[model samples]
Target chain A: MSETIMLLCAIAGTYLWRALGVAFSARIEPDGALFRWVSCVSYAMLAALISRMTVLPLGSLAETPMSFRLGAMAVAIAVFLLARRGMFSGVIAGVGTFIALVAFA
Target chain B: MGQPNHPPGGRMTARAVVRLGLRRGVGLPSVIVMTSMMGFGSLAADGGISFLTALSASALVWGLPGQVAMAELWAAGANLLTVVLAASLANARFMPMAMSLFPLMRGGTRHRGAPYLLVQLLSVNTWAACQEIFPAIPLHLRVVYYTAFASTILVAGQIGTGLGFFAVAFLPKPVTLGLIFLNPCYFALLFAGTRVRPYVAALLLGAFFGPIIYALAPEWSLLLTGFVAGSAAFFFFDVRPTSVSNAESK
Candidate 1:
């Protein structure tokens, strides 16, 4: 079926990068220039994705107001810094703030 | 308990290693995966995907961005090629992630096939957790620990997918929205906690460029933002020091 074929292609496309990483990792040095650049690129890419999800989200998240989303992120960052980079506290604060704002609004 | 050659408390049995991994997996990291996958399940349901198909995509793709892209594209009635391409692009972070992680996992093991299997289970949650935890783990047990940890989150994600699919009709909108928003918040906090200068610069530049470029070119925004911001950060923070040292030596 076409659906199954589509699914397979999706799987193959997604795995292509991981598989390539495995093949090239055997030859690549972790501390090399290439690795450093790649690491930067990966972090940048994750940042871009997170920003998009927060600023221009789809699905249920898109229903919330932009102020709430931005406020939640700001609060999370502040809490993370104040808590000495405790990941749990930051996440709990952000989610809690967003939920409270949305529920009240 | 009394092997003559074994160092005291320096090594553990495979069963004990796996138990430790399971315990670690059940913490905040797995909870993040579960809630995010719950969001994905709700999205898939809204997109008219069957429960089985959505769950299979979660398992097979095993990456939230790719799964979400695939679901959204399929829902929009896009062609097969477009769907595959979008999903692949969204999941491209796995390449660098695996490149970095595979080396850490390569020690004290001779098994050729284990990396292949472990790579399949790799996700953002598992990859991040492994980076934090692998240093404390013994080399021989690294593979087992990673396997147990990743598999636990994978199963948790599946359970979340099922719950979200069924609970969407009953749960309040704000609650579902909060569940969906957890991932971005968690990721932002994770990156904010990094102490590396180049990485921090990349994060800031990427965040600044993301929305602007997205408005201009939605499909290519991620790639473009990475290339521009990452290169700038690399040149300034990483390459400048080396070049200056070389000049001084000359």
Candidate 2:
């Protein structure tokens, strides 16, 4: 099935990076230019992914109003900073706010 | 608390280390991973993905970002290559993570093939834990502790995935949507929590560029945004020697 193939490709794609890391572990400098650049690239990619998901999502998430999604994110970030970077509380607050908004509004 | 029983020396036995690792796995780390995977499960379900497939993604992909990307792209009916590329890009952090952690893990190991299996279990949670815990563990036992710990969390993630997948049937639509939203929320918070300037710059620039580029080219937005924003951040915040040292000091 295509699902299985896609899963395999996903696995392979993910493993490719990990395998490269292991293979080049001895040679690669963790704080060197190459590593730092790669780290930045990954961070940027993740940021892009998250933003796209939040701003222009697919599937069920698109059903919600963009304002609601942005509001939830704002609440989550605010709580996260207020809690001194308590990720658990931040996530719960965000999800809770979204649920309340969706249920009530 | 009473001390754990050990051999004549203070060093723990292999079995004891394994037990400790398993116990650690069931602690706060597993809880966090479980909760996040639960969110992933709900998202997958909302996307009309089957439970088995979702569970397989958690088990095989193991990285949350990559798994989420795969699910989202697949649900949107993207081609296989695009899905693979997007997922891989999202999960590329694992490269630097593994590159850093593998050296510490390789200190007392002799078997080259062992890392291949052990690396498969390395997720963000495990890698972070190992970075903090490996120095205290005996080099010889590092691999064992890591394997046990990582495997336990992997199982926990699978359980969470299953729970989230089925909970959709009983949960209200709003609650399910909230659960699905947890993934992005968590990532955004995690990124915001970092103090690294280049990383922070990259996050902001990427976010700013993400929607704009996405409106123009949905398929290439992620890659293009990453290159443009990441390279900009890298050059602006990281290229200078003084700034590199300044960033590294923190």
Candidate 3:
């Protein structure tokens, strides 16, 4: 089917970069300026993803008010910082806050 | 270079190697990976993908986000080429990641073939953990140690997917939501907590720009936001080399 072909194509296209990265591993140094730039870009892109999911959410979370979402994120940030900015603590705080806010509202 | 970077003999027992891997990765991070994969596998199953197919995808593709996008797009009836294109874009992030970790693990007599085999196991979770632990591991054992760790996570992920696939009937709404949420939550916290300051800056700027871009153009927002926000951080780092060197020094 066309769908199957598409899936295979997607998988191959994605793998191309992974394969390329491996092939050129020696040539690309992470500490160099170019790597640093890409790292920055990668980081920003990741950040955008997280923010989009929480702030501009889609599907189910969209029904949950934006203010509530911001509050959950704020509380999570607070917890993350309070726990010396540990990731586990931040995730717990954010999810916990969202669940509690939903329950109370 | 004298003893080679990985295990000198390349003959360590599989059990010892696996133990080293587990010891290296046993923590909240690995737990996060397992849980996220479980949720991902379950969602795929719920959407009507076969259990074998889901596991095979994980085994073959290995990048969960790419796999998820591929399956979701497929289910939504996107053209095959488009699905593949989108999946490749989603996975473009991994190129740098693999580039970062490979050198640290390559041995003096580095079997080029080994890394290719290991590439199948290369995901963000494993890469991050390897970066943190690679320096501390004895040079000679680094390969076996990392290979063990990578394989364990791979097996654990497969098992998690199997569970997700089979447990579709009984999963509750709260849990399903939790599973979907696992993907983003782990990503945000992990990025936010990294010592990579430029990346952190990227996240901050990208977060701000993502919605703005999305509002302007819904379909292309992800690509546009990534390029725009990433370019911003890239230019900033280019101009401010001192900031990066200072952070590295500390």
Candidate 4:
């Protein structure tokens, strides 16, 4: 029960800024320097999450070896390039390669 | 479709706002968000988070990455502090999102309460859609329109997460596997959609630096890759001359 309450508090804390930002937009311009810094931090944070997923995944993905993961990424990149930067093909290629390798070997 | 018939003042009614939101939100952007959210919720439930927390996070955070990060950390038995830190880091990107819109929305409303409400709609899906659609709408309606559309999705996400949590057993293991993969797959695809030199540069640098940094220091890989790669890409693109930039700028 305490865990649930804590989780709720944390979730609310996380969203407080967004809710607060809009409420105060009359005073804040997205173009202000402070906003720019916020933008930078946001982009940086997004990059961090993406990197962590690719490099330090959890649960089932954690079981997949490093070599296989890297190799699958390479194949995905090659497919992406070959498809002239198509997003769907790149994903299919990467995921397909990973599954195939894992299933076969 | 041509612009919907407007009222005598050339404005949309409250009902119209809700209708437009439901319609526009059912399109590609909302689908992507819903797809990602469903996958995320399922993964959280399968991993042992209660349906309540998963649902509440979607309702509150409304940011998919942060919600996923929080769930993963909690499942891993990390303390509340670590979970918040990781979540805040994932959410730190919102600061930029909020900043970009603040300029556009600054003087439109005299009421002090509106900005706080508007901020809830500032996630990747809403921001990207608003950036595309706001210029087309009458300036005054942008906030109302976005609030309507975003609230629909937010409410949907909350409900979806709750349903996913309790219903995890009904969803097959293969489906859950697919859900776990969806989060990464979406980002990978979205990253590929960028054709800008700097964005492409950031993706490549991130891809290259990510694993390498992890091998060296797993605990700090996310911060290192983002700062190092993103800064390199930012400077490389930002410092170039305007004429050269115009050639590749999109």
* Highest lDDT against the true fold, candidate: 1
Model 2's DockQ score: 0.56
Please give the DockQ score of every candidate, comma-separated: 0.59, 0.56, 0.48, 0.30
How good is chain A of candidate 2, measured by TM-score? 0.80
Among the numbered candidates, top TM-score falls to: 1
- Tell me the spans in candidate 2 whose CA falls farther than 4 Å from its real position: B1-25, B43-49, B72-93, B96-108, B127-149, B239-250
Those runs of model 4 whose alpha carbons end farther than 4 Å from true positions after fitting are A16-44, A65-105, B3-21, B196-199, B206-228, B239-250
Using DockQ as the measure, name the better of candidate 1 and candidate 3: 1
lDDT tens per residue, model 2, B140-193? 777888998999999999988999887767888888778668778877876786
Candidate that beats the other on lDDT, 1 or 3, i.e. the better one:
1
iRMSD, model 4, in Å: 5.6
Return the clash pairs for model 1, or none.
none
Candidate 1: residue A53 Cα off by (Å): 1.1
Q: What is the C-alpha lDDT profile of model 3 across B41-97, one tens digit per residue?
A: 876776667776688777767777677777676666677676777668667666666
Cα DockQ of the candidate 1 complex: 0.59
Clashes of each: 0, 0, 7, 14
- Candidate 4 is scored at a TM of 0.73
Could you give candidate 1's per-residue lDDT for residues B59-128 as a string of tens digits?
8889888888888888888999998888888887778778767776666467776677678898877777
Model 4 C-alpha lDDT per residue in residues A1-105, reported as the tens digit of each score:
856765665666666656544444345434343343333333444555665665667665666676666677667768877998765677667766766776666
Worst 10 residues of 1 chain A by lDDT: A27-36
Report RMSD for candidate 4: 5.7
Off by over 4 Å in 1: B1-16, B239-250
Provide interface RMSD per model, one decimal.
3.5, 4.1, 4.3, 5.6
Model 3 accuracy (lDDT, Cα): 0.68
